[model samples]
Target: MHDAPLLPVSRRQMLATSGAGFGMLGLASVLDQNSVHAAAPVAPAVSVATANPLAAKAPHHTPKAKRVIFLFMNGGPSHVDTFDPKPELAKQAGKKGPGGKWMPTPFKFANQGQSGI
Candidate 1:
């Protein structure tokens, strides 16, 4: 039977494995304190057991919007031409504006969904 040589663990290796656990412990203490303080004077103790430090909670009142979608257009096509089509502006295409001539959108607009806006 061949015996394998054991290598010594470095400081960096030890920290990398255990650093996250230390960070989590620190985070938990901060969250516990914040939850206790954030609760109302009458129900201060309730928050310690009921409050979730990480989970998302609903607002005090029901929100009109259930979900939201954000579009981040960076160094691409124009948003007005692509998503929000202005039919009135299309009619006045090539017309002289206050600054310069109004340029028309190359793409055609078509209704897609039942709630067409």
Candidate 2:
């Protein structure tokens, strides 16, 4: 018996079919039970010391600051005083800046607290 000749496949049709076929093949290999790249079995540590798995661990390193004060001061005293203190801008008071004239901060910038950070 003579073997049947293959049909002429267009580049567009071949690419479309082959892309799907390759994707399916890759998915099948990944989903296979006896795959070489299978995930390792996740076994929990069954130790007496680590009985409570949900327990919090000790700090890796002692923090420099004891208390953290997160002040979200938008166009407030903290923003003007602590963070962005424009001394030059203060000197050039009423002078023409980017948008308008440079207005100096009312509150003076000084080291208040013990550790003035």
Candidate 3:
């Protein structure tokens, strides 16, 4: 009975669940592709008033943000040590590290001229 329980709940369960998930996902993808092929081709647009689902529209209200600056680091930055200041960031302060784990910066910060394009 001991070996029976162990065998029944062993690697086979994990493999079966994962295999079934992938199989269902594949089947769904095939069905979606088939349905797309079965769908009728949309008629060519005739007028500017012809509504396009993806067309841009005027906002209901004034936009809060006009410009956005996205500074994407090659790797993730330490939130606490960089922008987000925390009271308990002493452990993460001044520790130089790499990868996705917790890390700290080793560079000096100083005020410079206005930032622009």
Best by TM-score: 1
User: Model 2 over residues 41-61: C-alpha lDDT tens digits?
Assistant: 677677533887677777799
Off by more than 4 A, model 1: 1-52, 55-82
Ranked by TM-score, the better of candidates 1 and 3 is 1
Candidate 1, residues 4-73, lDDT tens digits: the string is 9998999999999899999999999889767956655474665643676765766799789979999987
Q: List the residue pairs that clash in candidate 2.
A: none
RMSD of each: 16.0, 16.6, 11.5
User: What local lDDT score does residue 113 receive in model 2, on the 0 to 100 scale?
Assistant: 85
lDDT by residue for model 3 (27-104), tens:
998898679566665776674356675678788999999899998777776654465434344476655547434444
Q: How good is model 2 by TM-score?
A: 0.28
Every model's TM-score? 0.33, 0.28, 0.27
Q: Order the candidates by TM-score, highest first — what do you get?
A: 1, 2, 3
Best by lDDT: 1
Error of 3 at 50 (Å): 4.2
Off by over 4 Å in 2: 1-82, 114-117
Which pairs of residues clash in candidate 3, taking residues 3 or more apart in a chain or in different chains? none
**Model 3 accuracy (lDDT, Cα):** 0.64
